[model samples]
Target: MLLENMKMAFHAIRVNKMRSFLTMLGIIIGIGSVISIVSIGDTMRSLFSSLYKDVGLSQAYISIGYWIEDVRDSDYFTMDELDRLKEIFGDRIAYIDSAPSISGEVKAGGNKLKFNLSGVDYNYQNVQPVNMIYGRYLTEEDVKARKQVAVMEAGAAKKIYGTEQAVGRTFRTEVYGSMTEFTVVGVYKKEVNAFQKLLMGSSDDTGAAFVPWTLLTWPNDLIYSCRLFADPGMSREDMNQLFQEIMFYIAKSKGRNSQDFRLTTAMDEMVQVDSVMGGLSAAVGGIAAISLLVGGIGIMNIMLVSVTERTREIGIRKALGATTRDVLIQFLTESAILSACGGTIGIILGIGVVFVGGNALGLQVVVKPAVVLLAVTFSAMVGIFFGIYPASKAAKADPIEALRYE
Candidate 1:
């Protein structure tokens, strides 16, 4: 009997195909919008993870004072402290490096360019491992001997030499208003994607050079930042303990509170970023739900109209012994089937859009199976909730009056 009722209900919808399709339009758009936003959000999270994975995952920074504070000269960390930290951490420490940079002009091959000149120890690459497309990275011997050798970023090499094959080429580094010569030992591969360029705030057309840390003059030289690398298997708690030990020693010696110094770990920052992205995704999805509500109202309105049109049919079915429960079930089934069709289509369209758009943007869209299930289930529930009044009204119809109506 239920199957027969379903056939009749489908027959009714088929008789008014255009109206049924129009009724489902709202639901399709609503579900599609929601799924697309969610998919994009998921992809963004993955992209962020990849961007920081190698460079930041096992990295952290230890610094004294906040940006707003007037830093005293005593705030500077000495080489002795850096060496002591290495001794204390021993094998647990992957690498410790510092980048002390200054803006300087470079002269090479009759081309003069202004570039960022950074002095770094050999371990700097352990934190930011460069893909050496040409020649080799800064070696321990170079840093130890204070060799006047430089490694160039791909963009920097291109600007000075008009090509990435700038290895073995010599460039003059300007220091203290005087020129000191250094040979380019390597060039790193450059990032060309627009998103990476914007996010990293680097112009591929610009140039930069790295030299040995010992070659940089003191008093006038200041370390811009320091990075510490931990072993890959190190846990957050272990990293925290290590940081704590260092901070406690620094604070005690300086007669300051530990909080006075700011230490940040990449793992902590990554977790924070994930939280923020999750909230953003949820908020956007919630806003998109307003359309679902509108779609539900549309379903209810159409179902009410359907009930009115089928009044005479309802009267005939009742005369032939159809019960109130039977009539209610038929209408409810019709509403559910209609909503399910729209939801299924919407899911397909949403995923299709995500894949196409994500591919174009170089993002890997990760579709959550649970989210898809929830959306489909929610659409069916909307049908049931909104179809209740119409189904009840149809069940309560007076056979006598309905049959006598025009």
Candidate 2:
């Protein structure tokens, strides 16, 4: 009986193909929107994990005081705020390795390359995990003694000696108003940020040259970032508070509000970023749900029209000793068929959207299995909820009335 109803349902839907397609359109759009939103969310999660690892998300770094969110905020800190920080915070805080950067040409045996030259303090070794491919990183002795020494990334090594053995090679870098030659003490692998398929050369560690921070400071500007590394077993919040205190004093000394100098731990910032993205994705999902609601309503309306058009047929079946249950099943089956077909198509379309988004946009559109299941289930619910009224109307129709009306 159920199988026969399904066959009849399909027959009815086929008879009005245009109407059926029109009804399914809302469902298609609904599913499509959901798929796109979920795909973007998955991609963002992937980007976050990958970028954080590459860019040193575990510990934050800055050119002035590291709390800066953008370039404009960084500029404000460099005027006079960073200097006052040292005077207030004193030794309870780790030393600030305000290694300013310089852009210049560095020359080796026969290779000349333009690169970003940075000066780092001894504590930099502890602050940042610079993966040395060969040799050793710059040390306190190098900075304090003003030793003619430098560190190179993989690109720099290749430019100079074409090999990691370039550790002992000397390169003359154009320094602050002078030409200086520093022997390469270390060579490190280049760092890359996430969004590998989107942004180019986004990592800070890529193709960099390093000098001692003691030998590098801005002539008259303040600082850019101030990084704070917690001592072992120290809470990140405590360190953050400490950093904020320093920023607070700097701001106060400068006669500005604490907000003038942003204070945030890297972890805090990263979590907030992820949270914001998550919220946006949820908003997209909510919008998609509205489409789904409209689609469900469409299903109800179409199913009711189908029942009305087949009123005479329903009455004949009932007259031929067909029970009300049989009539009910027939109409319900038609409704279910509409939804099942729409749902299957929606699933296919959703998967297609994710595939395109992931491959074309170079994002990790990780489709959660649960989400797919939920979407499919939601479609079925739409059918059931909307189908009931129409199916009941068909079952309750008077046999004589239904046959005579049409």
Candidate 3:
């Protein structure tokens, strides 16, 4: 009996193919919008994770909280204290350094080029490793002796010296109103991925140069901030404990409260970013879901029309001993099938959009199975919820009155 009812419902839909398709249109658009939005959000999260991993997932920073309390010069980190820290936590720490940078113009090969000169130590490479195309990176000797040597990007070297192998070449720049010459000791490859170019524009005339921190700072320079990279083997809990220990050690050594310093990790930044992205996605998705309500109304209107048009058929089925429950189930099944088909099409369309967009942007596409399942279930529920009034109306029709009607 159920099969016969389903067959009749399908025949009705087939006879009015255009109306059936139009009825499904709203559901298709609504589900498509929701799926695309969610998939894009998932892709963005994946991109962020990949980017952070590329840079250094275990990176962290320690900064002096002068805003919390006035910091005395005596409270600053000293070179000796840094060495002691290395001795104490060398195994757990991959690298630790204070990065001091200055922006200036350098005259190389008669071209004035803008450059950012970063001061770093031998351990800097361990934290932020770069591919060396020529010569070598800064050494312990270079930091200790405060050598006037620099490592430049290969592209910058070619612009300055007409070749990527610009090792032993010299470039002059003005520093503090004094002209200083730095010999190029190494050239590293500069990487610019698609996503970076989209964000930072072109990397043409601008380049970076690395020099020893000792050359940039005085013997008594006060260090207010430091960057630290933990060993890859360290867990989040271990890293947190290490941060606490380091803060305590520094506070005790400098005779200040541990609260006088602050530690920020990449994980913390990732969490904030994730929260922001999730909220944005949810807000946009909710807005898109308004179309689903519109689609549900369309379904209800069409179902009402269907009930009125089939009044004579309903009366005949009742005369043949068809139960009201059977009539209700048949209409509900028809509505559900319409919604389910629309949802299936929408899922395909949405996933296609995500894949195309992700490929174009050089991003990874993520379409979770759970999300698809939820969408399918929700769409079916919408059909059933709206079909209730129309289905009930058809079931409660009086056989004599319906039979007498034109």
Candidate 4:
């Protein structure tokens, strides 16, 4: 009996193919829009999460709040104090470095190319590893000797000497207000991923170079801050506790209030980013879902019209001993089938859009199976909810009156 009702419903839709297609159009557009928007949002969140992990999610920065307290040059971190901290927290800390940077320009072929000169030691690589394309990174000997040798990024090296392999080449930049020449012992490549490029733009014209931190700092120079990288094996709670202990130790050692220093971790930024992205996605998805309501209304209107046109058919079925429940179920089944087909097509269309857009933008596409399932279920429910009135109207029609009218 159910199969017969479904067959009749299918025949009705087939006979009015154009109208059925027009009715399904609304559902297709609504479901497609919601699916695409949600998928893009999830993809973006995943991209950012990956980027944060790649950039060292276990890393943290420490800075002095000069405004909070009267800071003295002696309160700055010294080599001996840094060594003591390392000795005490060797197991918890992976690497710590006071990387001071200066904005300088290199004169190349009558053009001054701006570059940031960062002072780093051999241990700096452990904190922020780089891939050396030519020659090698800074060594312990270079840092100990305070050699005037530098490692240039590939883009900067090419800009300076018209080649990426600019090893042993010398470039002059202002150091301590005096022109100092340094030999490039190495060149490293800085990889910019698709998402990074989208956010930070092209970094080909501007680049950075690394030098020995000892060369940049003088004896008794105040190091106001440093970066600390925690051991990857440590959990988030342990990492946070270790950071707080370090902050307290530094404050006590320097004879200042703990409030004088600030500690920031990459996880803080990650949490904030996740929150913002999730909220934005939900808000936009909710907006897109409004169309589904419109589609539901369209379904209801079309079903009402169908009931009126099939009034005599309903009368014939009733006269043949068909129950009111059967008439209701038949109409409901037709509406659900129409909506389910629309939703299936919409899912395909949405996924196609995500893949095409992701490929074009060089981004990773992520589509959740749960979301697709929910969309299908929701579309069917919408059809049933809207079909109730029309189904009931058809079922309540008097067989004698329906047959006599038309």
Give the winner by TM-score. 4
Evaluated at residue 270, the lDDT of candidate 4 is: 87
Across 312-351, the per-residue lDDT of candidate 2 in tens digits comes to 9888988998899988888777777787788778877888
Write the residue-wise lDDT of candidate 3 on 183-215 in tens digits. Answer: 999999967666665655566777788998876
Q: How close to the true structure is residue 296 of candidate 2, measured as C-alpha lDDT?
A: 86
Ranking by lDDT: 4, 3, 1, 2
Candidate 1 lDDT by residue in tens digits, 1-406: 8788779778877988998898888888878888888888887787777777855687778787676276765566766667777887797778776646777677887998878877878877766777889998899999888898999988788888889898999988676566788999998875545455667676654567788876774554444355677876788898878878877876676577778778888888988998899899989988887797788889899999989988998899889988999999999988887788888888898899999987887656898988889889988998788889999999999999878766
lDDT of 4: 0.86
Q: TM-score of the candidate numbered 1? A: 0.90
Candidate closer to the true structure by lDDT (higher is better), 1 or 4: 4
User: In angstroms, how far off is 267's CA in candidate 4?
Assistant: 1.2
Off by over 4 Å in 4: 66-69, 109-111, 215-220
Quote the lDDT for 187 in model 4. 95
Clash total of candidate 3: 0
What C-alpha lDDT values do all the predictions have? 0.81, 0.72, 0.83, 0.86
lDDT of 4 by residue, 282-349 (tens): 88978888888788888999999999999999999899998999999999988888888778888898
Q: Which candidate model has the greater TM-score, 1 or 4?
A: 4
CA lDDT of 232 in candidate 4?
A: 76
